[model samples]
Target: MSDASLNPTATDRWMLPEGIEEVLPPGAWQLESLRRRLLDVYQRWGYQLIVPPLAEFLDSLLTGVGHDLDLKTFKLTDQLSGKMMGIRADMTPQAARIDARQPGNGIRRYCYIGSTLLTRPKGVNGSRAPVQVGCELFGSDALAADAEVVCLMLHSLEACGVPATHLELGHMGVYRALLARTGISEAETVALFEALKRRSIPDVDHLSASLPENERELIRALPRLSGGLDVIGKARALLDHADLTAALDALEQVAQCVQKDFPDVDIHIDLGELRGYTYHTGLTFSAYRSGMGSALAHGGRYDGVGASFGRPRPATGFSLDLRALLPLIQAQATPPLAVLAPAEGGEALEAAIRELRRTRPVIRRMPGDALEDYSDSCDAMLTCKDGVWRPEPFSNRS
Candidate 1:
């Protein structure tokens, strides 16, 4: 119905929209291998697999999720019902809906791996459609639930052979508590949060200058709050409000357990970082690897995301782009060699090719496809000697 669709140019035929990508051959295979490997790890940790629909009613998809996600979601009208529909930007909300529909109050662990579309990429040069892989644990608010997901996130990286350099821990409670203490207007609090996350010292100072001295000092301290376990100690001295005790203790406990599992990993605590889903209610974290500019994987305690679906379940989970880790995966799956079978083959030859394919690939040369066509994939050739169909080593000169 649009001009571009009717009068498409040659460039439009071949060019993908910015941030969209196509993974070809070896790269696609590698992505698949990593996806399966990570899913296996989740299964071993007791997470059941789930496949949420790619699109859903807009309200159902975005319920209780904040405006940040809402802005990233792509919305369109459904032809059948003429109601608003959205392509899911993140599967967490869909997983929450599934949990809400389930019949019990017992804890549930769900894992999902699927491609999600976003209106804009999260970071510069990031994918618009990322293959998101994650596990969400619903029905428990215990710190143990949060820690389990944290430890599981580490094991997931280990399973995929990605060596994480460090993990940063923060609590949504700290920010919420700080906000309560600041007594700033909602508009001002939103502006301050934006400035703090960007670490814009001048903007942060200017924004909070109107606040009381005690609260302003605490607000200004956030940008400098990153790094090492000593951050917690500094936070306690600076943010020594009575309400922060339990939140800080939870941070220490989670950090201590992570240190036991991954002793070499640097554990940094930041009370000021608000780097997580807006729905996150308590602890939030991000894990980093060497050479990556942003967090490799991140998740936190978002206890009430399910409540928007009419089920007030506690939830925690983490998701990372499967293809994003392709380059960083320590080992690559060895591409299997194939046996080339001639285009003209008898039933016996067909049977032999099928059997060979059962174990490894067997490339059947199509009509007019010369030996040169099979050179890339085949290291051997299928031939009939006397009465037996056998594979013999063959080298096609290029």
Candidate 2:
């Protein structure tokens, strides 16, 4: 059916577009709790929280980042000013802009928790609007600084009650060097890179066939370059080019540092895993659990990204989608809050309700004609019987 025919008034209340949602039933307590816990972690680590404006000039938003991110940003012209504005699809660039505007003498740590809107293609299920919670550390490129961010991320996951999470480490330097060694045209290099991302070995093999003998060997070996810590040693041996060797050394150093401090943390090296924003310069890593198909958290070194924003500070940080974590983490069902029924013309009863709220989350009204029916919806029902407050038990399908 035509959209106009389905909603003749176009203003029909029931007709709404996809990719938008209403938060009803008021169960944001869990989400808020998660955010608070994460922010607490950031705070203890000396990262001050900041909330960047949701809208900015499209040019400002896309200034530093590469074409890939620029294409995905949602753009629109402001009606009042007739200036192009874009909704922030990512927060890191905004944070960089903020740092540039307010140049500091020393290092700065910033954290943010907010919602971002993105348009998902038709086949994808679930909400397109995602909640992004992340932290960025600026003005430090010390390898130890990068390690600290990874450690904090691991601890944050642990604080959130995530279990058996492992950190998969990789260096963008290694991946790019390997690609450059292939001696392929710029177009072919991009295609080969995409194939590696998709883990399509056959396609990579086909593409590598036209390259020099040494380059072909490097391309064909891409698939076997991932596993646990052993991949680091393999990468060191497999890569012969100078740039590739240097990248391998950096990855190895990070592996050693992580092992020294976090012995129990499962550290896997995937020389082929290259996924991050354009700002990522050196070591990049992500956290994953067995059940989730995607990384629960990912971040890496982006020393050059800050410079693009006019602040020549080295920075690195990671952000996790709290919504993505909900399905993976074990959810503890919170007991229903008690609903108190107001007494008829009783001032004392209202005072008592206010006192009760100090210790517990409370809902105020009982729904429906039958009081017994509504009782099950709350943890307990409070009502004044003969000028005395009484508590009654409530339950629902457990």
Candidate 3:
């Protein structure tokens, strides 16, 4: 791609940047309906809603989030102070900053849905501007909190009518423990993490070459440790470290709770699903529709996200692309048909229009406007007959 190639011709001037999109008509309406529906579900779960700023100081935005987000964020300079600023690529950190201001260690539940502008797509042809919806719980380290969040995630997908959803659970702490036992430098740990994420045997072997035999063997098995419930048992038997047990217990407990509640949801365990490996502190899970290659929703515990705000409290959450959900949202109710009003209207017609609008939409025809102007929206017209105004089926005459 060159500068010349970047130049837009007149025919392509309306072309949006790659990976960016705009929802139109009924799709936008459906998207809003899903947003409202899920937010209501979150409210019922006692997760209060909050709207974080779309952009903020760069340091404030990226300080405690991991390198993955650091790469996705779009940066700019604020004119007021010459300070660097960034458009939010993820709302989790901003929510954490808000939580850090709380007075006590009491559990605070918050939910948010907003536009997130990423510098690049998250996956192939993924949206760069996603209407991200998520819920965050702070101040609790118990596995119960993890389970509760997972439950809410299921409720979210169900509310949107997403079907055949399966969940894959992982524990970053397990991977972290193995990495720690290796006693490798920060750089080495990061390199090994990348290799494990890819599950490349050659890379894993090469990276763990100098590590202890036991430590190397444990981590080398982590990527391949994804499957049914038996994966938990397998990891327990294969891993010799006691530290690994706690993380494993956390994963199992959360998995059990999810299974018991969401009986139909197919569950899989993936120790290598190091979603935000350097960022997430503990149990992580992602939900996928049967055939979709990418996760529709995913979240994990990222306890240190608030440390930069001076309050290091436990936190966990998940986010999904609301705009991406428009197609899959099958149950949105049809909005009521709008009623049309004649441009020439007396006090009676005006009052009738107002009264009708109270229950449903009413589109008043402007002077010089024909009935066809609202043909796509309005079905009936308010008519003055005798002394009363009543609605009659509207027919376009010209």
Candidate of highest TM-score: 1
Clash pairs for candidate 3: none
How does model 3 fare in lDDT? 0.86
Evaluate all candidate structures by whole-model CA lDDT and list the values in order.
Answer: 0.86, 0.74, 0.86
lDDT of 2 by residue, 27-62 (tens): 365667778899988999999989998889987888
lDDT for each residue of candidate 1 in 1-398, tens digit (9 for 90 to 100): 99989999998899999999999876787788788888888888899999999999998999988888899999999999999999999998899999999998999999999999999998998999999989899999888898899988888888777868889899988878878987888799788888988889999999999988998898888889888888888788887787777788899989988888899988988776887626788999888987778888899988877777778988899988887887675254556678888887789998898888888888888887678877777889998999789999867834
User: 1 or 2: which has the higher TM-score?
Assistant: 1
Clashing pairs in 1: none
What are the runs in model 2 whose C-alpha is more than 4 Å off? 1-12, 121-123, 181-183, 240-246, 256-264, 277-279, 328-330, 339-348, 366-369, 383-392, 395-398
Lowest lDDT block of 10, candidate 1: 327-336
Per-residue CA lDDT of model 3 for 1-398, tens digit only, reads: 97657985776888889999998876787788788899889988999999999999998999887688888999999999999999999898889999998788899999999999988998787899999999999999888999999988988988888853699999888888887778899999888878888888899989999988898888788878989989999999998678799988888899889989899999999988876876888999999988788888899998867888898999888888888877666344554577888787788888888898888778778888766777777778888889888888877533
Work out the TM-score per prediction.
0.91, 0.87, 0.89
Cα TM-score of candidate 1: 0.91
Count of clashes in candidate 1: 0
